[model samples]
Target: MDGLLLEILTAVGFGVLGAVLFSAIGLVSGTDETATIAPVTLLVVMLGAPPAAILTFWMAAAVSKHMTHAVPTALLGIPGDTLAIPLLQQATAMRNLGAPHIALRKMLAGAVISAFIAVPVAVLFAVILAPFGSYITAAAPWIFLIAAVLIAYFSAGRWSAVAGLVPFTLVIVALQAFTGTQDVKLAVSYFLGIAIGPLVAELFSAASPMEARRMNRSEYREMTLAPDVKGWGGYFPNPFRVLDRFQTRATAIAAAISSATFVFSPVAVTVIAGEAVGARVKHAYHRLTSVLAVRNGVTESTYIAEALIPLIAFGLPLSPVAAGPAAPLFNAPPRFTVDAASGEVNNLHNLLSVPEFLLYGLLAVALASLIAYPFAMNYARQAAVFVSRKISHEAIIGTFVGLVLVIGLWEGGLLAVFVILTVGLVGGLLYRVLGMNTGVQFMGYYAAVLSVPALMRLLT
Candidate 1:
């Protein structure tokens, strides 16, 4: 009983920490989950955090980030993160209509409600899928290959991304082989490189003489601030009250459905869920608000489901969210790992039971609701104003890059740092040029790690 009580306290403490920290990070625009969350969680794991605390921390952070991310999306017309991108159109429309506050409230409300829905629904799905864990693990290589191709096809690049996968996978393979010759094995460097690829690519473009004119900005960018109108009386507004009955129903349905489709890209699921919900409403205003609610709700549900379902069921980094932001939870080596050759695993799946997953997952959501939800609800405008005017994008990028470099150096010294740079520059260019996004590239990394070995064995 004493042990259990301490466990609960630790989980709660970490949950609140994740919530408060990420809530602030979410206020700053363009903080990608993979780049920020993964490294921090990796540090937590490295520091020997209890499994329950780790789970709660990750869950709370993701939920809180999505909730507060709406501040930038709705108020400043800037996406707060990768998942926030899908919510931009409706948010921008709302801002133009002088109702950015409505958009912000609806997004926060939808996220809170959908997070609650997603936890139980995702766990249920995971329970149903758990029985197949061994079979799935046994066929991991082929599954990764197939999943990689499918995800590439589904990416914005379409056939181009699919074709791009071959070279991308080969580059990873070549890098690994070269590193193997020097007795250096690297994983996090590759992940970090891929996560920060876009930034690296942008910096490279800025330095190029040919792109000088395009990269140069003669004047400061201008933005119009929308007036805030408080719709509710208290610090905590009822999510259901913020959204009407039809909207609540649509968000719930979308959250449930997107939770089931956990293996798909979260962004893709978010966009599709919004389109499906938006198409049903007749009035343009109603459609826009409903879509905003559903899309933002999905931003929460999809991340929760994608991270939880794969972690709970198969213990593999199977989903895009799992492979990206949630990677450390599944495969932070020396602490957590999924062995490619033997299909052996030791990570969250072994540490936390299904019941623990559901319990801690809900706890994390509740913590986020109590902390990030209300904070964003009450201070969206202030947060947006501070982020847009005070925060420097370069500082954020440099901070993350420095953090990644430290980790890379810690893991494999100078070799790992170079590997990160190589992969980042190449992957970033591919992502910017061909629309082969991070999700597909992550799958390609898995293919290099899992499928290539299997194919080689078969050939031998």
Candidate 2:
């Protein structure tokens, strides 16, 4: 009785705390989930929070951040985060139509509904996959290689993205060889590299005179504000009432599909889900709103599902989100560890059970719904105006830069920083010009570690 009470109390307390913190963070345009989320989650683990509390905190953070992330996407006509990219067209269209507020509401409503649906479904799916955990981990090397190509193909780069996997994998392999000589093995460095890659690439381009001239903006970007619209008369509105039968159904279906395919990039899954919905709806306005709702909701569902399913089922960083933003949950060493040689699972998978994940996962959505949903629904415009007018993109990037430096320095000192910079430069440039997203690059990192050696041995 006492133990159950403690767990419930812990869930509520931390869930609310995470919602508050992340909701604000999400409003900041151009914030990437991995750079912000992974480091903060690491802090939670390092501080010795209970595994259940930590899980709730992290899940709530993802949910809330994605919800508020719609603010910048809808109002500012910029991606709220990496996952917000797909919704850009839909969001911008709504913004032009003077319905940015409506876009924000539908986006949050879909998030709330799909998030609730995704939790139990993801937990059940994870439990179903749990017995095969050993086999999955054993096949991880090949799985990563296949996942790399598949994700790259689905990305905007198409065949070129798929083909680029070879050199990208080779780059990771070369870096690993160098780091091995220094007696350091790294994981987060690759993630930070990929996460910050686009920024680094843009900065590098500024060194050339012609490129700098092309990059410079002559004046402040114009702002568009739709007339503020009220929802169906409440702080918290029903998803069903706000969203038509088709929109709600589409959101639910997409969330379920996305939950199962956790290995794919969240953005890719989002794009696929959005496209699927977009295909069925013909009317431009309805299609626009429904697609935006489903896509933004996907941002929540995919992140939640990817993080939960991997931690619960395989206990390995098998999915891109799992391997990146959610890595510490599985393999933060000293406190939590995954054995490289033996394939041992000793993280939240070992720490918490399936039932626990379900309960806390739902609790996370509840907390986020209570705080982030209504807050986003009510104050999205105000928040959007504040960020666009007040915050500078440079400041946001600098904060993440400082965080990358701190965590890298702590891990392997100067060597870790070098690895992060090297990967970030190459990965970022590839991403900018070639459309090789971080998701593919993360898989490339995994393949270099797991599959390259296997391929070599088979050849031998």
| Top candidate by TM-score | 1
TM-score of each: 0.97, 0.90
lDDT of 1 by residue, 330-376 (tens): 98887898888988889999999999999999999999999999999
C-alpha local distance difference test of each model: 0.91, 0.84
Off by over 4 Å in 2: 1-4, 278-284
lDDT for each residue of candidate 2 in 352-446, tens digit (9 for 90 to 100)? 88889998999999999999998888888888888877888778777777877897897788898888888888888888788887777877876
lDDT for model 2? 0.84
Candidate 2 accuracy as TM-score: 0.90
Clashes of 2: 1
Question: Number of clashing residue pairs in every model?
Answer: 0, 1
Q: Residue 74 CA error for candidate 2 (Å)? A: 2.4
